[model samples]
Target: MTAEEETRTAAPAERLWDLAGRWHGVAVAAGILVLTRVVQILLLVGLDRAIPDPAGLRSNLLIWDGGWFQRVAAGYPQGYTYAQNGALEGNELAFFPLYPMLIRALSAIGFDPGSAALAVSWLASLGAAVALHLLGTSLFKSRRAGWALVGICCGAPMSVVLSMAYSESLFLALVAGMLVAAHRRVWWAAGLLGLGCALTRPTGAAAAVALAVAALVAIREHRDEKKWPPLVAAAVALAGVPAYLGWVGWRVGEVDAWFKIQTAGWGTSFDFGDSTIGFLSDTLTLADGWVPMSVALILLVALAAAGVALAGRPWLPLAVYGIVAMILVYGQAGYYHSKPRLLLPVLLTLLPAAAAAARARPRVAILAISAWAAFGLWYGAYLVAVWPYTI
Candidate 1:
């Protein structure tokens, strides 16, 4: 290893202190997320006082997916239903378990299911921010870039979901933590975190792929990284996705029941963007679909920018992971309206842009964040109080 690489990898007491002090940026990021969510509540509740769906701002976080997760946590006694009213019913088993399990555990302690779910997301989002900061600092070799990455990530227009009862924050925390552990060559932590990720979301497979690739490359480059944990992580990653699917299938009494749950229950399946293109085409002729279309289009532009930024970049693992995740997301055709929310997991795509902003002046970063916050408040309110799409 080069002297500089050795210096970075072998951190002494001063580096540890610096690392601890640098958490100030994480504090700012967390505060920003809290303030953003607060603004969202203010706008949503103030604008639509007569709308009583969610009942109140505190309860609002459990509106859409939160309702599903809470129902799942409630045991989903109804179980899988292929159809209701002669159409796809969206079974509760279609929802993943870790988030709901967390909510259930919290509810066991006297918290309302909705509030518990929201608390999981809120706390997980902050944890994810800290992990993202560490991963960014390691990858970019600049504390400014790390802080900027945190700001940019939480500033994503849909970041309001970070504070809701969604699993995105929890999944992100695991993913970011896995990335940091791998970067630090903490093989055991990486393996265990990868297992945590495997249990969290399907995208965990993408992370496993990226990490394995990095590990293999490190071996080829004679970096002296361990060999076994990567294999174990990959095994967990490969097995974990199937384990949940298989269990759901077995519980439902059909070997292909998991895929059926996605199709017959929720109408979700791979369509290679045909459904997406069709949705976009229909958007021009339909009035009611405009909001979802606008959201998807804006996200498309951002994704395109991210693709451009990541092309030819040096961060192979992150790029591969982000690209693979995006491919899987875009390949799926069902539920076109939720595309933006679906893309939230592949956030490494934003690193190139965030790093550039970090290289700019502090005011530039402030302006970028300010603009996103202004628009995010409106977008977040729309999601909470108005939009019908399940985020």
Candidate 2:
């Protein structure tokens, strides 16, 4: 091949790896995590001071899923039982074991469960940011674009969840890693990551779908002549579903503990048009002060949908993931509060926009991303300050 052709062929891979290996990426990711955690701590402290009653504050600010996680972390699993409303008639099997399991393990290592959970989440958030950077660079073939993508994630509204004791960060990291492996045609790695993601969150099924579709496309384009590892990888990724269900059944005496728990505890049954209409109605009426929040949410949702629609064929895997995730989110009943959290993965939609902008006006893309990051920082700080009351 000619030198120019060779350079062009190798440039994307080289740029991707170089960006992945850089100290700048590491520093930026670390900075985001640190800032987020600091905000969390400040929020906690502020809540404590404002409430005066520590118990009441804890019950309010850090209650719900956070409280349950703390209990699991404290090595008190024997009394563990799911409750619909503080009553122990429900099955604890409904809750996935991954995050709580990690919290328990970390507690065994001498760290408090709360601290351990937060620490793990913080690290996972950083990893997700890095994975996002690499994914963007690979898809866009520009290190600068990758950096901008990472920067945007650092500031994304979802940073609030990343800083908390939630499983979103870890789930995002696993999903991103799986995507990276799929892109490289590393089937086994993709499958393993997908399984891990499944264990982390139920919505992780989206990763398996994305990978499976990608593999199918690869197989068809090659007329089954090429050895496509993605087929096997996709299978491996889906294996987590049965494995997790079996474990939950054995422990909770029900095969659908996870589903039941989500349904009963969170009222998350599927309801497509109703949920969407509810959100839209609320947005229009400005009900529950939904104006600003709705605007932001709509912008994100629209961008994600547009990106998938515009990609035509090259972005099939991402499109599949995005579409499935949106369906899952919007299909749920009583989705007003949780919809934003569920749409966290949709942030990947920004990747195509970042790519298009980088190819056209790289500098403008960088500036825009930087502005988003700044907003993220400010929003995170505000959340920390008012988390006890509003979060």
- The candidate maximizing lDDT is 1
Q: Which candidate is the best by TM-score?
A: 1
TM-score each candidate: 0.89, 0.79
lDDT of each: 0.73, 0.65
- In model 2, how large is the Cα lDDT of residue 84? 54
Off by over 4 Å in 1: 1-21, 50-54, 76-79, 82-88, 284-289, 312-314
Clash pairs for candidate 2: 82-92, 271-331
Q: For model 2, how does the per-residue alpha-carbon lDDT over 1-391 read when each residue is reduced to its tens digit?
A: 6798568545644656775657776576566456645655565466556654454423333444676667655543332354556654333454566777887887888987777877777778888887777777666666666666666665665456776777888888888778876775556777888888877776777878888887887677766334546777788877776787677666667666656665765566777648666666666667556334654465456556556655645467877887777777767775364555567666555665566556657678766766765655555534444444333
Query: Mind sharing the TM-score for model 1?
Result: 0.89
Candidate 2 runs further than 4 Å off: 1-15, 19-64, 73-92, 221-228, 290-314, 356-363, 380-391
For model 1, what is the C-alpha lDDT against the true structure? 0.73
